[model samples]
Target: MSTNKDTMPTALLLGATGAVGKALLKDVLQNGKYAQVVTIGRREATVDEGIPQDKLVQKVVDFENLNAHREAFRGVNDVFCCLGTTRADAGSAENFKRIDQGYVLESAKIIAEENPAPEGEQLSPVHFLYCSSANANKNALFLYPQSKGETEEGIRQTGFQRVSIFRPGFLEIETARSKPRWAEGLALSIFPPVNRFFNLHMSVPVTDVAKAMLTVAQKKENAAKGEEETTLTGSKAAVFSAKIIDELAARPLTQSSDEVLVVRNPYPEPRSFKVKTTAPKQYCVRPNAGRIEPNSKVEVHVILQPFKEEPPADFKCKDKFLVQTAIIKPEYESLSISEMWARVESEEKESIRQQKIKCVFQVPPEQIHHETKSEQSTLDNNNVVVNDVLSETPTATPVPVPLSPVPQRQQQQPAKQDLNDQLVRELNHAQDKITQLQKQLLVKNEQLERDENGFRARSQANGPSRKLPPTVQPQDAVHHHLAALETQRVTEGYPPQVVLIVAALVFVVTYLFF
Candidate 1:
């Protein structure tokens, strides 16, 4: 896509106090392309010395109540978000999630919905640029990356016209902070050297990240302007790796002349290439022609001549460098550089491959402080108007909106009430989950208590048996013998007594018979 050079857009910046955020603020102010730079934060940002404050409109608001500060977000064309916090800094995972995930997402929603276009202008697509971490995945086991991923996912769903997520690797923060981060410092000390030596895109300076973001936004804006030369590659929801960020942020340095270009051969056949530039007077290409073995790469040095006068601010050099490559053929194998190119141009045109890289100039950081008196006055007046509305009270809270699996913004009919209703429904759903968990816990506790009681009852019932020795009998088992006396009386005393009884009985029987 091509970008318009004439459009000067307003930009809304969040988290200006952070390392990358601070760098972004600096770059945005110095670029001089943004018509206005609105900053929203909890406290006043500590602007650096020499940074122009004219374009800056800082608002101190309650981030917790972002609704109250909706005006701060109005009329912005781009959003640069660097709002994030560590679990340790936030004091807990929940707090981290609230700040990293909740705040980031809610802010996106507020800006996307509440922010309206300037009067008399149609609402243009709002480009969202987020600073996310490398390896950020919603399904990640760790909280930090997971939260970042979730935040990125959520912001995409907020209906922004374009969503660019920058996943920078280990950041080397140069800005001063209240507390030092030992982990980052350690990594910065150990990883960068290895990263460079191996050409691993595992570490990047925070400033580079800021510049990369600006580059992307600039490219997108330029595309909007219909600049035929601008070729903004990537998806609507683009993900930039550290390497891509560095590449996009490439700019000529005033102090350095040497830059490296890497040419690689992906095919199994040997390849020959020649490098040429439109700015031959300003740049020198070393070993202008080279051959690369199959599956190998060669680094070419591009030396820039010192500028007699510094280029104008926001200057984009029209000069370009082109690399032409072709497979090595035996027919032109021994030909001189010019002859080989001539032969290839005439015969092997179909096999010739070309790539072009345009030259970009870095805007001086001090440009912000060097504005003309009248321009400075105009910016100051604008800042005054913007400052008049700054307040300490927080206003907007994210009214719940339906989240779609696809990257589509849900319709916000009657915006306010629908958001509130959706949020209430989500809250109710969460409450139901909590209630179900509580009931299950209660059931488990009751079952545990019943099991305990049954165990105790069984223990008590078998207590005596458990206490008795296995070999011992009870006292009821003892027996006694008492047969002797009864037997003697019946056998001896029965002679007289029994005979008298028998005779009496016989006489009675005879009398009765007669």
Candidate 2:
């Protein structure tokens, strides 16, 4: 933990605002190896993690519109992606996928691609460590699992040169975070045994999970290794493969002298993490103590690694480790309209930030259209339409002219009226530009499609052309389409070339691993 700052590997923490991520931030920042630490979070935490205020990079992003943000990922060395949202919080399964699945994959893809080797003197590629769910599967029966699985698969396929996926279980809620829609405490008590028979699954403490992930990522090389290790790591990996998990659901560690057992939560208690460090010098710790709101309960239990080579039958604390997972729930089940308004308002801020690049390129184009398009504004007043049009305008052009100035004496009313008129003009000009760009994009796409049709017709006529790889045509189209989009976005100002390059890189990296 006392490593020098110069020795630290730069890590980008994507979900640093979360309880687990917050833990990682503390450990990573305090350890002193932190050459640099950057975070992309939904909202600003009231209390800053120890990282310098400037070091903490926050982005208000609509998990849904991740595609528009690939550029913002530039220069990130390693990415710690722990971004997630539940269906209840999101209001529907579809919304959950948009955040959990879509945001996760899109963020991974960009991180894999855009991360440049940290530069200054030395050169090293970026690392990617993701916090995935235990039951993640693209084709699972449940919505959450299915999205998580798909997200995992997508990340694996994306070419992040170095990627590590951490799948912690439901958790041993030991933090004090509040959630609006978590299962009621009574319901959790009534829930039946899960992961009991399953050799691979287990709930874990959030703090331990965070610490372990930080430990692995701090190694630097974890991301560089080409092979994908699809399991929990650090202390968790050790506990998942330990014997004590079966001996005691809540207690898993035994001291060297065999005198004491370390359990997370003692009997007859909920929302608390207890440590019974009896004999043999076992450590008594509430790992999640440094991480979350105090009200959260930790319910993690595990059946660890299968018995291997003949050694001691006794549970050994020295050989095993695990973490404390936190569960953050709000105070209510359903969001009131006002709450929804707040949620939407909060969600919109992120939507705007991500849309900045979108508008920069997507709107600037004459084809996207400056007029006759949707004059959309969010409830938060994000002028989606005008921004799009104005964004696309080539910087070469000055803004549309303003109206006559307000005269003195009638200053108050006239100035107000004048300001309103000027805004109208700006909005009009933006709309027109957007329309022009939209039309151009439409025409370009159509032309490309027609060219493909022509090529197909020719291939059909020649027969031999069909021998060319089917992948070739599509690949060409994709390349062409993507290139055009890139160029168009640049011209319109939706995406910078840096962003597109990063996106492509993510795809390549993920593809290699998958």
Candidate 3:
């Protein structure tokens, strides 16, 4: 579908701090399709540096008090809900429900009620986009999946006109916290290679999930405008599986030159392809009908011709085109059915087999340069006003003016002061270290004293018959007595020489400071 560049939609982002939610926030801000993005989280959203704050609105809110902030949901065109948490993070299964199910459902209901589209409109202004888990079932034994399933059901019952739910398996989060779960790490390591064999739902990256959600929302909006049918196939509530999410996340191959477009066949078998354009005169594709070999790509060189000799001032030219590829299988005729019905069924299958890719290119006029210049001028005026305000403000103390360089003597004074400060810091650090060591020494001395006292008491209790052990020689006894005496003396106080050194250092520091 062609995007109306002139019309910029506004979006609201919930759970904007999670891995998937952060990805979505970045994409929404960078896409340029949205004029404003409102992020509601328990705290302010962490946005990347240099991203235009003009387009971002951050609202700190408590999920439990969502009704008080009901106005945040008003007038939003798309609501991307990535709010969820694990049972462990939530502390209990009940709290997990309060967030994953309760918060999500409540927010959806409020958005639907507050941001309803005009009467008779085909689509509501608020398109509820949700992030759900794979294999989520209300009857599941696991608390996490069951909570997600109940949340999905609750969202559907809220009666939103457009609701898209994405069920991705284990997400490979890039920005996860440091504490690692061995099970999750093991699964992430083992899941990718065997994912396709297991229906491609084992694991996916957080960024892909984010991309899929945004892409599906944009496609649904386009479909509502009658631009084209949405690639998503479902009833009012569209559900995208992991495989579909991966496909939606994949970017279509485009040539370096704007005029040329490239299409690749990732499958291991050769496939027939076709290319068609709505404006044949504007674009010509070479080798439009052909077959691509297994694991090979077809480069359809699109030659764009000038639309007019002298284009009008308001001439905005855009074209929509389609590229289709198909793989045929001859063994499907074994099904039990009438020959006529079989033929019709085979034809239907073949028709559906062809994968169609739509591409749009637009050439807008050159009036954007003037608009940028005018915006720059307005910014300059605002800066001037700010500077004027700052100039008018009075200061009690005179501001220090920066001079070219200080005289050599003046520089020497600061250098001495720096040395003095460094010495003071070093002295303090040394004193702290000495104090810590002294405390440890005191603890050890007390322990030694207690042991000696216990030994003496035991000897006294046994009377004169309990003599020193045979192994305890006279020299050993003398060494033990000396060690105890030394320990007692050290514990009493510092030595005289050490005291004198510390006093000398203190005197020098005081003299320097004065």
Candidate 4:
């Protein structure tokens, strides 16, 4: 499953409106890696923040009718099932099970069966990622944990090529609560400082769970690209514990940079690099041209001098200037690259910092239209006239009119005559063909009757004295013979009656016209 680098992946999201689900949706959109994000929920879904509408498709569907929307699962690369519910929210244990276990399992089953791997691929095309509780156990006495464990089993049994189950502890959501829980609030307040010291797998942030899921998906995708192995520590599915989840979430947004400057080599091989920039005219790169060894580091110094031109009143130069860098390879042309962002700011004194650019935004130009008016002056009969008189007076120049080659009447008369003549010829030809077919049919019918009668007479005369070979009865033979005659006549052309009627119509038309 080596995928094209330019091809963006598509993801299907369940429980998009939930806390972790919302965070996951934002990360998927903001990462700009997914080409399409399909969110399915019982009601219409909306993003809390703005995102690319082209990449997001919201499908409002009834969970009870999952089968009806089975086609939606086709061609999906990753399924993020964040659907969950509490017994209180669902009003009963049965309802909670229906949401947590039933819906999740059914969706996974459909996705596994519908989304098949590409031709010649061994693994299932879709990867299943489920969010389960840390305490989830199939034999657990509690219904909630039991339901979550059942869902985990159900997803694994669906036979997805790769499955990543996240068993996160209690999630801390910053948004307004739909239902207040005193125990969750007390834990959130007390667990942050002491949880790390005691190694307690208590509460975790909603965002960390979302980030962990994305990290797993990206890892699997990279594995498919042959950048890494599919198996993680001898297991196909990587189940992240609470501590692992926190570490992943706490990871730096980008590669660490030096206090003053930073440089990164995304390519596999070491290459010579140079830095260039436009505007401000104060930034300078020391030893701009240098070779960066493979899997190594390079430190460069950037000096910022005083600006020559005064800054605009509203200008914010924090992240304004474009820093262009290029890589020089032997026997190959130099290529410009902008994989990192550099910002020079005056904080008490001038300073420069660089970090990898995660996302790029391009603002389109605004559209506006301007209207123009033209005025013309005309002189009529030695008196000047403005726009008003120009409309009343005729122009001196004559306008030419197109003329037809023939008059309308004459053109139509010849066309009508030609049509009538063509019709007459067709009618005559048809009548002749029909008459010939009818005569042939009658001859064949007569011959068939005579043969039948002779055969019957012979059978009667022979009686029991001579035994004759088995043959069709006289009535059946006559019926078959007549059927053959009718088929031949129809295959030849129009029937006799049809030809006669057409001929009579043509005669009447000609008589009336002439």
The lDDT leader among the candidates is 1
When 2 and 3 are scored with lDDT, the better candidate is 3
lDDT of 4 by residue, 1-514 (tens): 5646457778999999888898888888787777788999987566755666677888888899999998777778878889998888899988989988999988887887787656786557677788888667676898988888778767766776677677676677868677787877888777665544543436667776677677667654223321111111101111122111001000011222112233333235544444444532544546554555543445555444533332221233332222222223343334332221111122211111111111111111110112232111110111001111100000111112232222343456787799999999999999999999999999998987797676656656767433342564556756456434433232677889999999999999999998
All candidates' TM-scores? Answer: 0.45, 0.41, 0.45, 0.43
Error of 4 at 42 (Å): 1.0
Q: 317-420 in candidate 1: lDDT tens per residue?
A: 57766656666677767877678778888985744544444555533334444644211100000000000110000001111223222211123336647889
Whole-model lDDT, model 3: 0.58
Clashing pairs in 4: none
Worst 10 residues of 4 by lDDT: 242-251
TM-score of 3: 0.45
Cα lDDT of model 2 overall?
A: 0.47
Off by over 4 Å in 4: 1-6, 119-123, 196-199, 221-514
- Residue 68 miss distance in model 3 (angstroms): 1.0
**Candidate 1 lDDT (Cα, whole model)?**
0.61
* Candidate 3 lDDT by residue in tens digits, 338-438: 34234544574323222223332211213333344210000000000010110000001111222233244345578779999999999999999999999
Report the lDDT of model 4 for residue 153: 69
Of 2 and 4, which scores higher on TM-score? 4
The deviation in Å at residue 265 for candidate 1 is: 20
Q: How many steric overlaps are in each model, in order?
A: 12, 88, 0, 0
- Rank order by TM-score, top first? 1, 3, 4, 2
